[model samples]
Structures are given as structure tokens and as C-alpha cells.
Target: MDQKIPYDDYQLPVVFLPSYESPPAWIPPQERIQHPDYNNELTQFLPRTVVLKKPPGAQLGFNIRGGKASQLGIFISKVVPDSDAHRAGLQEGDQVLSVNEVDFQDIEHSRAVEILKSAREILMRVRFFPYNYQRQKERTVH
Candidate 1:
């Protein structure tokens, strides 16, 4: 149990800064946002496509690998000593491109992973984005 004592007076600061009479005219205009080519470069792998760096213990594991980010490929998180993944030519750094001849980005996370596990053998394609020659040339000149 605790005894209560009440004898307090409080006052907050009410200072006000001088208001701007007029804004300056030199502000630069904002740029228009560009849309991403999700269908081309960003092929969704799976909901669990994000492989944690290490095994999840009692505490929650997984980080914002650039959060909500659609990555280019599937990065291998772990290599089980004796597992089907390891047995089926899946390496630690393998990138999954397509499953059953269909791109993953076309499907949502839940559907993609379910299709993968249930089917036992996923017909995944591995594709890579060609280097951007224009961007490379610009960087070289700069």
C-alpha cells in the first residue's frame, strides 16, 4: 500500500516564434516517382523466401533485409547437413527463379510456398538480370 500526497502546481512554456510573412521562391520542385519493373527483375520467391542468417532460437529471428523489399533472387540462408534441399542440388547460395515454369512474383506469398512444399519437387528456374550497360557507362564517365 502507498500513501498519496497532493501539493503541486505546474506551468508549461507558452512561447511563440515569429511567423514567416512570406515563403522564399527558391525551393526546388519535387521529382515524380517512377514505378518498379516487378514483373521483370523482382520475381517473388516465397513467403519464407527470406532465409534468416541463423536458426531461430527461443527468441524471434529475422531482420528487415531492406524491409518489404522485393529481391532479385533467392538467397540461401542455411545448408542442412542431411536434408532434401541439400540432397536435391540446392546449395547455400542458390537463387530460385521460377517454379513449374511460372514466375513467383505473379503469385502471392502464401500460394507460392504452399505450391513448393506440397509438390515435393518444385520445377524452379534460375534467371539473372543482365548488367545495365547504360548505367555503367554513365558511372564510368562521371
Candidate 2:
């Protein structure tokens, strides 16, 4: 006759398995979990290209902050309502990745301002990153 084991007295066997798995070789380094720049949060806000034409003697109607002085990447500080930038989908707190194919990710404030002002037709690659922008702003303020 088999005796029934009490539920409280029963023991479960512990199994040990490898916790890490190598990612596929085809995956790009940036997309890999182990990459330094890998950030799952950023995937949700994919970079988008915004094309705008500046009317003669007219401002783009947007303000930009960040750069070497701020120790932050270029970010849109403001976007005027019904402006060219606003109509083109540019929003405040959006990070500017590049302008006219020129990397704005790491640039000087004056240089960035010059680039934006000099270009009549702008092609910018940007992504919404309000959290980062806010943190950077706070850091610069203090």
C-alpha cells in the first residue's frame, strides 16, 4: 500500500539552468541587449524625419537647447503654435538627432544655432524624449 505524503512535508526538486543566452549574430549591436547604447524605452519613440521650408526672413518658430554648454544633446525647447515647425510635427522636448544629415547629437550650442539658422530647408531627424530633456534641463539649471 502506498502512503500519501502530507502537502506540507512534500519537497520540490530545484533545477539549475543557464540564465544567459547569446543573441543571434544577425542582430545589430545597437539592437542587442548587451550593447552600451541599447535602450528598450527608446524603441517606443522611433526617430522620424521632419522636412520644413523656411520662408524668406521668417523664423522656423522653434527654440533649441542643449549642446556642449548644457552637456546634453540637442533638444527642441519650444515649438510655436501654428508655426512651420509645429505643423511639421516638431514638438517641445523632442531630441534632435541630426539636421540636414549633419550629426547634431554632439555639437556646440553656437554651432547648432548657426546650422539651424543658415539652412532655409531643413531635414531633421528627431525623436520624442521629454524625460531625458527634462533631466538634462534640471542638471544644467543647478
Candidate 3:
């Protein structure tokens, strides 16, 4: 009706099909796993690097609520006055989102702990992206 009822306005379109070739079953499939370390800020970190005294019956955890409620995760927690993390540019309340270019959000906490504890003197790829605690919040103070 919007086109003034014109019969020449359109036509049925033609379709084309391509040939298919199947791969041999012997060929191994490529890996589908993501990097397993791509950290997303809204997620809780496994705290894989620390050997801290956890609460009774508690496991290693990142302080997800230790900062401004809106920017809750922007701050790193309890970096030692002069520890490896402190030396490695980790500051108290510095939002942590990565270790060696891998995000904490990409893997399970157990796997992350193993990766962090495998070696005491390893360099990790780290990224610092603003994270929202919940999907509803996105405004950043910085």
C-alpha cells in the first residue's frame, strides 16, 4: 500500500548452489578452545597467584566488592608492600583483568590457580580494561 500498489516493484530472485567437498575423516579437527585466559572484568578472578590465609572453608578469591560499588573491581587488593606482584606493577586496588595477556574470565578457578602456581618466576600477559560489576552498570569514573 505504501508503494501505490505497483505490480512492477519487485520480482522473484534467482538462487545459486555451490558444490560441496567433504574432508577425510582421518584429518584431526582444529582446536575450538578459546585462549582460556581472556579476562572479562565483570567476572570474578581465581586469585591464582597468592598463598594467602583464606577464610575457614573458603577458597582463594578476588575481592570483587572491595572498592567503589560502581567501580568495585577497578582496584587491586592487598598488594604486599614489597612483593613480586608489587614489583610487577601490581598496586593495591588496581583493577586486575589479566595475567600474561590472558583474561581470568576465560578459565576455571582451579586451572587458573595451577597456572599461577606452576612457577614463581614467570612473566604473564596482562590487560587493564575497565570492568563493570554487573551488566546494568557501564559508566566509568576514570
- In terms of TM-score, the best-performing candidate is 2
State the lDDT of candidate 3 residue by residue for 30-129, as single tens digits: 4323333433344333343432333344423332222233433333434555554655554444444445555654444444555445443444443333
lDDT of 2 at 35: 66
lDDT per model vs. reference:
0.37, 0.85, 0.41
Q: Show model 1 residue runs off by greater than 4 Å.
A: 1-68, 105-108, 127-142
Backbone clash count for every predicted candidate, in the order shown = 0, 0, 13
By lDDT, the candidates rank as 2, 3, 1
Provide the clash count, candidate 1.
0
TM per candidate comes to 0.34, 0.66, 0.32
Report the lDDT of model 2 for residue 120. Answer: 89
lDDT of 1 by residue, 31-85 (tens): 2123232243353222223221222222111110110123333333344655545
Which should have the higher TM-score, number 2 or number 3?
Answer: 2
Off by over 4 Å in 3: 1-76, 92-103, 133-142
What is the TM-score of candidate 1? 0.34
lDDT of 2: 0.85
Which ten residues in a row are the worst by lDDT in model 1?
59-68
Q: Write the per-residue lDDT of candidate 2 for residues 1-142, one digit (tens) a residue.
A: 9896776675777444688998755767556777654565656478999999987788988998888766678899889999989999999889999999999988987899999999989999999888889977876632
